[model samples]
Target: MACVLEAPLRMSVLSEVTASSRHYVDRLFDLDPQKVLQGVIDMKNAVIGNNKQKANLIVLGAVPRLLYLLQQETSSTELRTECAVVLGSLAMGTENNVKSLLDCHIIPALLQGLLSPDLKFIEACLRCLRTIFISPVTPEDLLYTDGTVISHLMALLSRSPYTQEYICQIFSHCCKGPDHQTILFNHGAVQNIAHLLVSTSYKVRMQALKCFSVLAFENPQVSMTLVNVSVDGELLPQIFVKMLQRDKPIEMQLTSAKCLILTTLPCLVRMCSKDRLLEERVEGAETLAYLIETDVELQRMASITDHLIVMLADYFKYPSSVSAITDIKRLDHDLKHAHELRQAAFKLYASLGANDEDIRKKPILESGAIELLCSLTQSENLALRVNGIWALMNMAFQAEQKIKSDILRGLSTEQLFQLLSDSDVNVLMKTLGLLRNLLSTRPHIDHIMSTHGKQIMQAVTLILEGEHNIEVKEQTLCILANIADGTTAKELIMTNDDILQKIKYYMSHSNAKLQLAAMFCISNLIWNEEEGKKPSLLMHRQVTILIKKLLLNSNICSAQCIGIQSVMGNIILGVVWIVGVVRRHEEDAESSLGETQGHSDNKQELERHRGGFHL
Candidate 1:
């Protein structure tokens, strides 16, 4: 060998990686891991060398060693930061094995590092928390106790813009869990969010708003707290007004709109009583109503209306005992500024009968609202048609008996015959629904069934037999339950040859949605009782088959499982109820023949029980 010479050039601590340096790292990894670890230490010293090299070393079973280096008081500040970065990456990665942090007081030391004079150290701590938060499970207690994370974060942000930006990102990720969210809210997180609205950095504001949106999702009370803060005049309006004045980002605008829709609607209704809301109220009311009307591209309007109508009807039906609305005059008050709502309701009804221009030309044709709705079998949109039928249903229930009669007039034998043969299954299904209601009342049912009994029965048979749409089948099933009140219907359906096969076909249908609907129909059909025998022998057999099928499907949720149990339980109860009813009927018949017998209280109890079933 030539004269032995030591390598004269050692890598400087601040040297950054170049193409040759990267090649050197590659060779070190391939040739020897001892050399790679040496390289990692050198890179950590060299602010100039590969930061990636230090992080990569941790992935390969070196994270615990790196973290140990970070904890040593003698370690260089730069080296400690590099080690933390590597550890952070390891904790975030799928292959991390450094669980020994539990034994070492690493969390307290990391919190100390977060306050380091070196910016790199603070950045590294933020990154560490970020990585830890991404894990499926988070260790909250350690971070909360040592970091005192939220309080320290607020204090740091009050001092500097750059610090605020970094803290917002960390807080956004940390406050994702509901427990953390409650902690944040309890410790002035809402005010912190509001403070960031005017943040100098775009990223900081965005992150802060994102955090606020998540917190507000199931916690409208947070939004209420935000609104209650004394930042602006009359918080709700001020928020929207300020939103329009500023060049708001689209995401912020969307978030504001969603939060406002949820929190503000109820607030606005409450505010309606105040003189301030009434003064110059029409313009504001129209604007808000238009926004609600257009929200979700019109899908939510019908749902909203459904809720309001049901509330109104329930209140009308049972005032104090079952009041759906506590304030009787709210609708009247809303009507003052909500001319649009009144017009919209009329327009909604109009659409049921309208072709194209006929809609705009007339307030929906109420003269034959029911008949025209029945005829919308030709409409292509099934949802619209179904809704039309539902609207007619609500209209029929209007307190005015005239409205109900006008609906019934069109459901005569001739009209029903045409409806029964319509190609659109929903038309026939809805028609049957109307007929069921008409027949449920005194005099009319027996009258209609006697004249159009055979045809109406045939129509009912067709829907039960031939309808394929699950929704149509469900409606048809409910209609059958309504009409299946007497011996005539019972005999007709049981005797019909096609009926059993159709029921069997529905029971065997492969589609889950269809199966559920069919099951519900079958459940309702046999839910009632005949005398003391309980469920008829025929009904018991069908229910047993259903129970067997339901038990086999373990994928079902507890709610659906409970529903199945309820139906089965009711079926069993129905049998017992029927037995009791038969015994009571026999007892009454026997008592009528007795010379002297009176049990007025027993008769009254039976009457009350019978009253429970009438509606």
Candidate 2:
């Protein structure tokens, strides 16, 4: 073993061996892969003496064989280290196949590789572990499974000099899975990571801070726990003060700034709740909001959320906690930090709220943010107005009492109701979108009914009556459909003498979209044949208009045909009612005046004169 480990193999031999292995895997499928694997391993042992060339050959050419060998054998310390180099190479290579090599026992082998006396081997294994642990997949419930993954990772991180960097990288990868990250935190990853902030290597310190930031931002529980451990108990500020004095590396400074931001966003959320973290929450928000506003948007956006999510996932993986600590200097000497960075970050953060699902507040608040959002409802930018309305809706649903008054205060029953009258199709579309969400909340529904319901109905009725835009008209009908159970709008649209005339105009429009929408709107209103109370004269006129148009228009396609057919069905119902009325009139006249009404005087006469013969 010593001679094999000590012998300096020729570079040509190593190259030829590695090439042969690649050929076997890449082209010579007929070759025994086991023999190719053994040859690669033998060459790895012989080439160990030459660090530079050997590591490259093992990594670049022999990785597939090495991975295959890992499954076939209980790797010895030397073999394991060599295989780790190959794994690390594969990770760094174009073929990203290392994620599939998860092992229930690989952790111990990695630990053994980390302890190997060969410096090259140790470096390679450390790199390999860094790659392996970054897997985004929530390694299945390891309780009866791979729990050893975290334990073994912790053991190596505890002993490895690059512990901080490794954990940071792993956590960075873990940020993709919030639940899995929390699990890592439960296993003492947080405190161990925090210690690295004071490391001699600036790279290590930066990485540690980054991992902490990820944990603190993405997982609220971890954020709260971090606040308890670092801010409430006073651990973070001390580090901040110390960092201020040190000539920290640029990367380290950047990481610290990011960690500061990560810690602040969630802490601010908690602070908004008035908990024990009230002070820390306030301080953190002020700090982070400042950072976002003053820092470069690109840099902050790149890391703040990403890092926070990673740590969140790790903490979810393991929920262990150490003693709580908080640090405070009690002065507003906030660092002017990165000015351009802040401005860019703040704008980006504000923009992100539009896409962030977690910011689940109503579009209106009883008194707070919902009210603020509602105030912005009149913003000239359609996107802003839409987003503002959406935010208010979410707020109203999430914090009904908090946002109820704000919605009321911002727009009067009439003015707020008049918003439903906005000319912008997108604005109306968004309002309906907001209403759709608000209707989901019981109190919100009741509030809408109590405060703005009638006014809203009036506005919607006008749009349904005369709106020229097909999109607005269609969405308006849909909104009515959503609120159909309790409103008089449906009855008015179905039986109102004048509204029925407007619907007939739409049915006759040259635009098929308008015709289709009109058909749909009329169909929705005529749900259950309740028009028996109203006279059928206006309904008969509408039926006459549509039937005559359909029969004369041979160029109409199936969509129009279907719409006309639907209109025909409703018209037929109206025609039947009209026939009943005309027949009654004829009978009454015959009884009282002894005269019969002429068949030529029928409403169908008008339909026939209008060319209503075709189907």
Candidate 3:
């Protein structure tokens, strides 16, 4: 009886434990919606607390569930926001997690959240969108369909500085395609971005500039739109220039520089249209000139625009007048405008002539640019004169023979001669460079020598004897060399005692460049002549010293080796010519003496024959 009672109690205890275990299993797998959301929140918190939890959550299907919660219309804002945040966090997680988020098609829902009024929700959505857009695997067309997503984001640009910054960044990514750039522009992105350029927030302004940069980069239509907007408002261009100023942050300045090249430059090129205001055209040309000076690509791009040449010529034809200014401020402003206009015009002219000889001739000369440049070279304003001569120099550098002839004929010999006496050293240097280019060609050499040869020689002599910059001295020496290239010019240079003394003086100077230039000048004087007819360059003591110095210097390593070698070779040839001349002179003297003695002997023989006939 005792054993039977113990067995029944054990069975009851086993049944009660089985019922409790089944109830606990049901509770663990509860399907309650609130319970499911709470569980998700806990997982999100865990993922946030420990980034390592993201991989675990991804493995457990958290991405799809969060995306589903975002798709639910009745989902609370908090829940939807949390879902977006969690999705964004996961997107920011591992590469696999991003792949998981993308696979769930979360972009549309996040874009919907962009329409939400709550800034945090919008920010979370933007973060998610930004990450998705930045991924290489994300299809470009994913966010773009009928332009709705881009339109919505552009609408959000006016919300807050933070929102504007994020929206601009998103647009920057979207603008990777021409179609996307067109869509963005169609939806007032250009106007919006132009306004954002003046935003009080530096971050917003930076992002806005970057958006403009991306949109305008290689997109001519968008660049034109931004430029038009800038012209109508006159604010955007100023903002661009302001950002480029030294006072702005370096980052802002750098971004501004890029915008100036990729956007402002193209816009300025287009703005060269004839109907544009004179002030607007001048500003555009000035900006282009400033940019092309620092970048070769810009120079090439700017040169191709045929209208820019026309517009610049038009401005040169009728430049802004400061003559009527009575007020001091107006006078100052007019003076500044005149200076900038002249500088920009000349620089653009130089850039256009950099490679193409046709550009140097057809458009420039047709537009009367040569006449304006010639006139400006004589301007009382030093800046005008400097830039004018500089433009002429670029025009003449490596120019075709025809182009050089055109330049010489366009600028009178007297004007060019007067430029040689300009008080400004820069003016003098550029004038010499132009003269060198002109004198390099055979046709222009006669005009230069006949008209201004004496004055040029005198000016060069003065500059050489005076205390001037080494560069100026070197350029003067080059001009002298070019002058000596022609037979007439060479004779004139050789006969001038003062110029010869100057050349000899520079040959012995401590500055190696001056010495080299002098050697070059001397070598040209005696090059390609008959044996005994070459000028006696070897007669000067400085020439001997220079030869020895060059021989010694050639043995040493130097950056100037090739140039030095060429000069040394020319000098050696000159020396050999001199030696040949000396030998030819000696042989001629011996032949003459032989003839004289033979003639004397013949005369005595004739006289003896006559006396024998008489006997």
Candidate 4:
């Protein structure tokens, strides 16, 4: 115990034991059979629990001695097992230990032991080989160049389920580098890994999945081969989907998801090149989209590929037709497939443009995504409409003015307005959001106001009055705020007393965003008002009270609220004459008994003035 506690003492003891063990091991073959077995047993026991001790033994020349025993024709199975166990322990130690084993040429002996009839010998040999394979100091060129090591591992994969997991782990370690991945695939390792996916042992299956995932990652040829290989008429894609089931272990699901992403890379490259058949291209796009659906990094990677955006854009335009299928069930299946393709395309488009304006321009707008999305909004399928509107919404957010105009021209104004009445809450919500984004462009706002102001106003009012979704109402308020930017539009909105009332009501609502949006609309409505033209009646006592409450409410204070307060201050300053008129009325009332009633009547008159402001 003291030796374990003190590093120098431990090293001294290990050095003495290793030196004596080396002397015994050197004369092991010359000794009697029982003595040779005892010497090897003693060597194995010396390093069983201590990696530093094992490393010391390797430094003292135990590796070559152990390799000699493994290579001996007359060595007993017990002697060979002990030799393999010692070698495995040595290989599992420091980098110097692995380097010593490789320098002593022990890999061939370990490979030989893998073919032994004894399961324990084979397992020990595999453990050592796996350790060497994973060691950073191990020469990758040496292990993969001869092809013999990979072949032996593939052989062990078929030997027994007990050994298969270890062999799979070895393959996983070897498949780390691109050069090694090519070697493994060239030796049919990818196919073997695919076969092991159906292994009854979950451990084997997981290791195999990991091996394939490592092989598939960034190795285009390996990815292509895995996807092209078919077993029982099912490709690797189908098997990966099956492994991604909800009931499977999370590790398996995660591995399968990653592998699926890698497997689709080659297909995507080919699709981008336009070198594949239409069916193949569509299949690849669908698979890639499914694997990277909600994953941001993979989506970014997929978006940057050469022809991927163009290919997906074309698919968006001409979804696979389901009419060719004659059977009703097949027809249903094909229809669902078509719908999935459209959904995948739009989802990918949304992800691609979420952060990149170049993607929005090149892949989305220039690729005719706007036209396709416009057409999709008229589809009978609710999912397609919802996805199309959502994609359009993202496209319009913070977009260039010219791009916004192009999108507006591409979309059918009537069709878009009709979607505002959509039964699906999601569809309506997305449509309202899209409208809000479109209104961000000043030109688009002017066009909508001049051509379709009444319809647009009606749509917003209907949603505000009838819709229940808070998000939709918030978007509606944003649209009203934008529309009120123009004088004619402001007058149109202000004449509608109900719209004004709703805006005033929302100003005091519990939701801070709604309150802000309504305040913004009110601020824009009263912006730069003339003294005589001011909506004195509309700025009723209750309206002013609400604004004062908002100003004093600590919880409601935000950056946007502060901006609104500045605007409210400007509105008050602009209507200084109105304050003077109220003051004069107070003075007139102070001189008479009827002044109190007059003050009350004038307050009611101011309330009526609030209704007339064209907000």
- Top lDDT model: 4
Q: Could you tell me how far off, in angstroms, the CA of residue 557 lies in candidate 2 after the best superposition?
A: 16
**Predictions in order: lDDT:** 0.48, 0.48, 0.67, 0.70
**Candidate 2, 166: how far from true, in Å?**
3.7
Please report the candidate that would top TM-score against the real structure: 4
TM-score of each: 0.43, 0.43, 0.56, 0.57
Where does model 1 exceed 4 Å of error?
Answer: 1-56, 59-62, 65-108, 115-120, 137-147, 176-178, 230-478, 481-615
Mind giving the per-residue lDDT tens digits that candidate 3 earns over 1-615?
011112443344344443323332233234675665565565556567454456555544456657767767777667677777777766676555566666666777788777777887787788778877777767767767646777777778777887888888777776777787777788888877788887889888999998988887766667666655763457566678889989889989998887766666667787666466556766777667766765545665566553667677655544335564457775665555656666667777876666556666676767777778887777788878888888888888767666666666767767766777677888888888887877775446756677667776777887888788899998888888777666566667767777777877777676777876877777666542333232544444444444445445534224544555555644554454344444444568556344434445433343333210000
Q: Candidate 4's residue-wise lDDT over 1-615, tens digit each?
A: 010113453356464564565565565655687788888888778777787567555555566667878878788988888888778877776666676677677777788777678888888888778788888887656565565767777767777886888888877776667677777778788777777788889999899899888887766667778878876778988889999999999999999998887877666656634345445555666566565556655665566555567777666534335564467875665455666567766766666666556667765677778888888878888888888888888888777767776766777668867788888989998888877777764556676577767878888888888847788888888889888776556666767777877887787787877876886776566542443344432345444444444455554454645644544544443244344444455567455344434455544454444422222
**Consecutive 10-residue window with the lowest summed lDDT within model 4:** 1-10
Evaluate residue 258 in candidate 1 and report its C-alpha lDDT on the 0 to 100 scale: 61
Clashes of each: 12, 68, 0, 8
Off by over 4 Å in 2: 1-42, 45-106, 113-124, 131-163, 171-179, 195-217, 225-264, 273-489, 498-615
Q: How many backbone clashes are present in model 1? A: 12
TM match of model 3 to true structure: 0.56
TM-score of 1: 0.43
Better model by TM-score, 3 or 4?
4
